[model samples]
Target chain A: MKAALRNPVDFSQFPDANGHFDRYGGRFVAETLMEALHELNEAWRDCRNDPEFLAELDADLAHYVGRPSPLYYAERWSRQLGGARIYLKREDLNHTGAHKINNTVGQALLAKRMGKTRLIAETGAGQHGVASATVAARLGMECVVYMGAEDIQRQALNVYRMRLLGATVQPVTSGSRTLKDALNEALRDWVANVDNTFYMIGTVAGPHPYPLMVREFQAVIGREAREQMLSEYNVLPDALVACVGGGSNAIGLFHPFLNDSEVAIYGVEAAGSGIDTGRHAATLCAGQPGVLHGNRTYLLNDEHGQITETHSVSAGLDYPGVGPEHAWLKDIGRAQYVAITDDEALQGFHDLTRAEGIIPALESSHALAYVTKLAPTMRPDQSIVVNLSGRGDKDIYTVAALEGIQL
Target chain B: MNRITHRFQELRRAGRKVLIPYITAGDPHPELTVPMLHALVAAGADIIELGVPFSDPMADGPVIQKACERALAQGMTPRRVLELVREFRQIDAQTPLVLMGYLNPIERMGHAAFVAAARDAGVDGVLTVDLPPEEAAEPIELMSAAGIAPIFLVAPTSSVERIRRTAQLAQGYLYYVSLKGVTGSAALNVAEVAEKLATIRACTDLPLGVGFGIKDPPTAAAVARIADAVVVGSALVAKMHELADDPERMRREVAAQLAAMRQAMDQAGMPTAFAG
Candidate 1:
């Protein structure tokens, strides 16, 4: 029985003309990038509804990026939880092994239409860098990825993979020498080369258009899941869950279901040591409202306006800020955010691999770990959909190191 | 007229380019900041940009990053930076001082509170690196009510329409980033900077002070040729980093660097007045 009786929530009302959602998300970039952002906003507004542009985007998404990834019902894993049925949205099955390509492909096409000859991005775990590099290669455009020197050392395989894909992996060695530093460096590069280069931001973070734009691109996950759920199960799931690093994957899975009043959504943040210990990247759960990386969202900072260092077993989930829309959602109580420790995520990594023969990315494992707790509490007839954001091949080294065994 | 406009006007009447030197408050040590301000004035700095030490300075290079780190470690807060300004105002009320940094510190303190505190501390202007014009309404209004000139940055990549918007929104002189990169970057292309300044000048009568690559005396002189003011930051901040263990040498060396640039700018001020 699909009990659906509620007032509909309008989707178009949010992120007003200035790109703000009530109080969150705005064009908070340097002045040099204002015109470029305005141009991008105009181009996106024009292309979003244009039939020809939509045709091109849809064609690329289907033929090139492999859209409408399967929604697999994890029967064995669902039985193990013993409370609710579980379905995994297989974003890992997409080309480049993650949901990140969905956005990189969309933005690269926009970049092409805008006459941009090069694509540049910043990546922490190298997932986005690879995705951006893959799209740039497909578009016959030059690509450069700014990665922190530390991340390059940590994610050596991904660095090699990016280089093999014909992208220049520039190492940034400033500040804490991680994703934030790489992001700063990438912004510098974009400002310097705004004439020829397009900054294909990997997440639903950054300034105004990016948070809105990336969510629109990645919303394919939720849109497909919505149709698949109705066609296969005859009902929308009781809940949707995904990990929230910069909240790209989570936002993608949650956006389409936003107006569906009964479908609950949850965002799991990485609690490295613990939220109480202040070492985690759970910005929404533990942070205050402040500005960083172009938007005023939740931030992990000290008494002064300095960004604080964050820790996580998964490099992809270690950023200090979450997406601005997520902040708005959290504040308005549309979504609930919880933190899962590194050990808990690691347990999730082993459990899914052993039970369902799925090697989920450490980032996706965070989402799985949350569902592990949440699913067991729900009724047996109820079900939940968790976005399996990526594969775990990138985490072999970090997982091995956790057990004191070098990979 | 505001202190910033009046100072620029005074410099214009004297046929000399304005020299603005920047130092992170509480960098090296908090106690030395007041003396550093006085020394900068003595070294011919027409205006001073007191960096409100922030933890994450994205637009800055290594030099300002370390300076912010040291200042933060020493427990420098926005209020402390304001206190330092109050102290500087005690000795010298003539030279204008601008508070500069990312917006988090100010946002942490309410915008109205920060503006009021700045006004009370005799801060004539402010330059928030990350506060773009589109998102600057409330802060601009607060600053305007407090008679604090809200400074804005105009990068080389800024379009003419963008500059016009900045000109309408901005209260003080525009801070022109000479190059596309962060502070302490390589030397800028003079012709390119001159071309951008011309586009900017067409938008407003506001004075433009160029920084972010003017590291040495010649570069300062070169930028001073095409702009009304020459602003230097990372070069002097780098000196403070090198002399962290020795406060006397830090002050002396930083002052010497500013003095050289000031002398160079003053010498090159009249010949090339915003012209090719």
Candidate 2:
């Protein structure tokens, strides 16, 4: 059943000229980075319309990055839930085993066109670090990744992988010694090296151009999913679900479908202990609007506006601030956001592995966890699509240690 | 006139350069901040930058970052920083005070509320590190209405167009980041900074204050030769950290360090008029 409806909100008009999404996103960086951001905005605008640039980006995505990943029907898992048919958007099958590569590949291309010889990024769970290193290696550009010291110790395998890919993994020991700290360190590095360096931000956050640019690069996911649903299944999914930290993957899947008024959108956040316990990374769920990093967004800060520490079993979801679009989306009532506890997410991970023989990343497991709750509330005739954003190969050691097995 | 403008005018008339020293508010100890500020004023600091410690200071290097952490750990908040300002104003009303930090704390307090409170606390100017002139229309308007000057940073990478734009909105003095990095970064190249200052001078008549990497007497002296003011930060902050155990020594030593820079800058004479 197709519904022909005109969307009240036009998605493209967002960030309106100055990169603001209804007062959520703006360039909040220092003056040192202003002209550089302006230049990046200009370059992105130019390349966005250039056929040659599109051709090159398309060629690389098709051949090197492997786009148009398949949409898989999780029949067994859907039957087990017993309420709605479930489909998984297989972003985990892409190169680098996650949705992170989609943005890094595009940004690396843009950096190359801008005549940048170096790429710098900040990573939490190391997926983006690996993706950034992979693109930098392919493009023959020097790469540096700022990772929190705590994360570097936990995700040592990805640290080695990035080093093997010829990227320097700089450990940040400031602030909470986590993703937020890494972002601060990365911004410092960018400020110091703005001339020859391009900051390849890993998410749909930061100041202008970055959130908009990263969203545009990632929108390929929703575009493909929409076309695939119409052509193969003949009906759009009743619900869309994805995990959000800085929200690149979730935004990628949600953007194309935003104009579809009938579609229900859900963004899941990581609730380490619980929301009431104050140890969660659920920024939109439990945060006030404040400025941080480079934009005005909902942030987990105290009464005095100091960024608070966040905890999550999954490193990627442990952030105090979310992408500004998510904050805007939540405020506008266009999308719904919920939280999944670590225990529940772990259960979802095991349930998906056992039921469908799919080893999902812990970050993606949050989305799957929500689907287990939402799918059971809907009719079995309708379908729900959850973005399996990455594979769990990197999490084997973590799961093993939790299960009392030495990997 | 606003105290900042008055101070700059007074210095200009005196053919002397302004020496601005920055210290994190409530650093070392909350009780010692007012004393430290008084000591700085006694040391010939024409204007002072009082740092409101935010947990994340992206524009600052490790030295100031640690200072912020220390301050935050001691329960320093934006309101408390204002209270400190009020205390400092009680004794020394003439030495203009500028609260410098990132924007979140002020944003936490509504812009109007923050501006009104700042005006009440006798804050002469505000320099939000991450806030440029482009996204600052509302705050700039609010601060201007409250009779408080809105200070802005002009970086080495700032374009001529940007300089003109910032110069239009800015009051008090424009803080010129002497290098291409965060506060307390590498040494500044004087010729490079001088050339940039000339470009900036072409845009407006706002008095210029140079900061970032003006570590000691010699560097401050070098900067005083080319700019209207020499603003020193990390050197004093690092000095404070060294004497954190002794608040009396911390105040005296930090003041002595600033006094040395002031002496050196005074010996350098008034900066040669911008060649623009």
Candidate 3:
């Protein structure tokens, strides 16, 4: 038997012909909306390579969403951990208070460029809903956000925020009444309104163009962090860390650093309870490779091959499956994946709020927990950069309620 | 026995209700799969449905998807699952084995190649969950050439026209999904199922296998009273997940469950055990 030769392009050229990222990402959508996705793919391909489009996006990121969010050197926390000097990329400082706004702004602009008049989005924790609504408000485009009924109750403030921004929030009461259900409802909605509605997905999970497109939009975090670190520290940070739910934040922090052989990337998944307890959201750490929600990726499931309910303190990170690109990254050994329990994240959340006076989102606290672990073992000269993906205002009340502490 | 047909005929003649337990290969760990299969057979499973894990299993609820994830994580593949069947044939040649999965993986492996491989692997039947009977011609013909029964699913939502179409190509027995939603969902409404079974029975004399939401011995027994086979998947798969690390314990628990169901079915008025 003859061996087939392998392709030589890097991860950027991936999802080749068949929509596979090393047999991971592919179109697993219904037949009805394949044409819309294909059209989106064609538009994205043309727009991504256009200098004018790139320039416009760059300007939007810089002036609109406030890109190049500062790299704050955490000296006190660094000294307390005793591992290495730690720098935080303040994506949480962005206009919408999270990295989600970056992708939503870019996507909304692209939708306008493609002549889309209306926008639809599916949200789990409602961060993306708020971000999408912000973009729609800015662009004067009609917006509808589909969120699971369960999520609407848990994140009522975000739902209110979306409505305040002129976007209609539709609560989906199907299936588990969570992210997956909202996604299914959104897909159905897209199929029904495929002609004019631009479905703006929240993360890098879904089918082909989504994982690639969202990653590209979020990649700005890593690109800016790398340049900033090089200019300030005169070297690439020893390790780059971020939380992985649907993996958009982690992929954003890791994508630009992928070509840097010397830089190590770490993705911290939420271990709601613990991996052994079978109640965690550590898809890459504890899950198996499978297909769900349009992409082949690591998923937490059971013996009959069914997807199980995932647990995490952060509503944003509570999912059973992860982006296929994360699977490809794990396969290629470009990224190291780890998990932090809810307790650890909560502790980190408290530590950051007290020490830095920065309330970090519960999802971003997972990365902070990793930093707490990584800092203790690093050399004094080595620096670690953590992508602080979002602010913690939305999570403070929930965390305080869990701890039985009043603000 | 002439394999599936003969097994069904023998079951009918003996007035026995068949017990089918589903298990995803390579779950918990890939290496224990063959042993688990042998154990399932020993545990009172009349026929085994080996599920091939696919990424997008839309028909499955959470339990089955989790099982697929575990199996796929252990690097389970169609070829590997077939090898498990072949290895099981070494000790138990009479037990019928069915490969249940979606069509994409088989299509990826090429239909012709898959049929040949499945046959070589000692597979007797194939059930593609998402493929309708109208589009099942190519794969069904290929499997028929290999003497493998191609099982089809009939739902409560299935019109008489759809049932007639599915029955035309369906061999072995008709698999009637008792619920409107995915597998492992709510319990089967026996009355509704009985009506649907009657509708299906009106069309063909081929044995009817009732599955989806038939969880416990009582449900299985109730289903046995009206159907040829009671296919219990989620319940069995749940046991596998619970006993993933201990194959011996899994075998004992699963076998005991099946035996209890078998006994329940026997008491429910089957003429004999293992009847079609």
Candidate 4:
């Protein structure tokens, strides 16, 4: 039925004035960061609307980060499944080999316009760290990235890439020694040095303007996908699928299609081991509403409200908290959240590489894993577009270690 | 009246500056926390800030962060904290105990339930580090209704507008983060704090307590000369950590430090600008 366009509620008006999407998202930092957040919010507002500022961003997106990544139809994979036709939104093709560079470039431009000379970021898989380092190097700004000590070991390749790009990678030894710890350290750095540093958050999380700002920057993904679908394929896909760690890439794709009633949105979270085993990063799938890392969102916490340690084969999807928008989307039934176990995700990783000659990032493999199940449930006439958020080159070590193959 | 307000008023009438010492609940050992509180009161704490250990304390430096780790390792939760407060109330009911921590644990405990439980446990005030005044309306209302004061923090980066807004919502007292960084950070500048307090004083008449980097007694005395209260946290917590294997020594040493600050603050009296 063509009845999808009847309701047409505007999804762009989110985060109200207070940076809240209904009950989620708010300024939940120390007072030291309140004014800094307010300043960043105002600057983001001005830069997002200013023609010259946007022009610079667009030029950089074109010449520097390589935007408008191809939308490829997965013919062989779809026919083999004997279900819905599948397409891949190739964010993996972007510079730095991931979708993370899109938001980093935009935030870097804003930081330059705001006269900030230092950039600080936190990373899990180190893609965002590398992306932040790349932009800071290009803009002649000093960059420092906080990474978990464990991740510094797991993602040594990206860590070396970041250092090679002239960014200092500070190892965080606090908390669970992963992405969440890295973020806490980064926030501490921001609080201590709020005067001159711009915190370039890589995901659609954090305080007020960040979830909104990162979403807008990443919306270029959905915008391009929408245009390509209309101009090339003549219709929107029946559903959209993307991995949700902090829900950056997923929200980027889902935000543009929120008003499109017929398009089903599925946010895939990493269920390390399995949800029933009480070890997973499937926040929206298993968590309750709570605040952490500067914003209120769905978080994996114990009965005492302490954030639980999460396990995931994919480092990027190992966060205890998902973005507030994803929480709101799940609560409002705008998007369906599902989880893929490590074994299933590994299978999806191998399946994509063997069938499509594309070794998807372990993070993106979670989405492809969901697509493998959901595509077969739909008709052959239907279509699905999965965001291949990053390439798997960074995950080669992890995959090889798992397969017991020496490099 | 709330115990916090009453205590501050009594201190003001006595021409004595308030000394608030913070210690993480369940640190070193959960059994030692109540005894520690008593020792602090005997030493000269007009009000006490009990630190609720959170797994992730973003606003704390290495000192308090490690303190929280030790406490949480001993199985400290919001409920356990209230139980500790209840036990402390059993012996000492005069000293106003303020529960200080991040907001997630309380949010998990539910605002209404946490407030009521806190009130019943004899807690006088609550200072959630991450919850600023703008997002504090619900908690403020709940805490006020429960006769517990909702404390707020004012930072060096806080503008006049934010100070005014926070002043309106703050109950009992205002916690002025004396420096721009987290707790246990280096070097407290008294001149800078005094200048910022003057700006904050114009916004509200709430009692202003200076924290973050008030290390030794001399620094405490310097802060006491300008602020209504002096809150010593990291230095005291660090001392507790050093003597964790021996609870009695830890309590005695912590008491000595607080006693020294109390003596220095008494000698310094109150700030002339804020003197009645």
**On a 0 to 1 TM-score scale, where does candidate 4 land against the true structure?**
0.98
Off by over 4 Å in 4: A1-5, B270-276
Off by over 4 Å in 3: A1-9, B1-276
lDDT, residue B263, model 1: 84
Residues A120-149 of candidate 2: C-alpha lDDT, one tens digit per residue: 999999999999999999989999999999
Residue by residue across B197-219, what tens digits does model 3's lDDT show?
A: 99999988888998889889899
In candidate 2, which residue pairs get closer than 3 Å at backbone N, Cα or C atoms, i.e. clash?
none
Please provide the root mean square deviation of candidate 3 (C-alpha atoms, Å).
11.5
Interface RMSD measured for model 1:
1.7
Q: Which of candidates 1 and 2 reaches a greater TM-score?
A: 2
Candidate 3 per-residue lDDT, tens place, A1-407, comes to 11112313365667676467886887765333445667788889898989999999999999989977999998888888887899999999999899999899889878998899999998988899999999999989999998989888888789899999999999976456777767766775675567788999989998778999999999999889999998987899999999999999989989887767678889999998898998889999987786667777787766434467778888899888899989988988889999999999999999988888899999999999999988888899999999999999998778978989996
Best-fitting candidate, measured by lDDT? 4
Q: Which 10-residue span in candidate 4 chain A carries the lowest summed lDDT?
A: A1-10
- Cand. 1: chain B TM-score: 0.96
lDDT tens digits, residue span B1-276, model 1:
678889998989998999999999999899999998898899899999999987667778778888888888898899999999999999899999999998888888879889999999999999999899878899999999889999999987787877898899887799998887778888889999999898889899989989888889998888888999988888888888788788888788889999999888887875545544
Query: What DockQ does every candidate get?
Result: 0.62, 0.88, 0.04, 0.87
What DockQ number belongs to candidate 2?
Answer: 0.88
Task: Choose 1 or 4, whichever is better by DockQ.
Answer: 4
DockQ, candidate 4, comes to 0.87
Cα deviation in Å at residue B119, candidate 4?
A: 0.6
Q: Which one wins on DockQ? A: 2
Q: Against the hidden reference, what TM-scores do the models get?
A: 0.95, 0.98, 0.65, 0.98
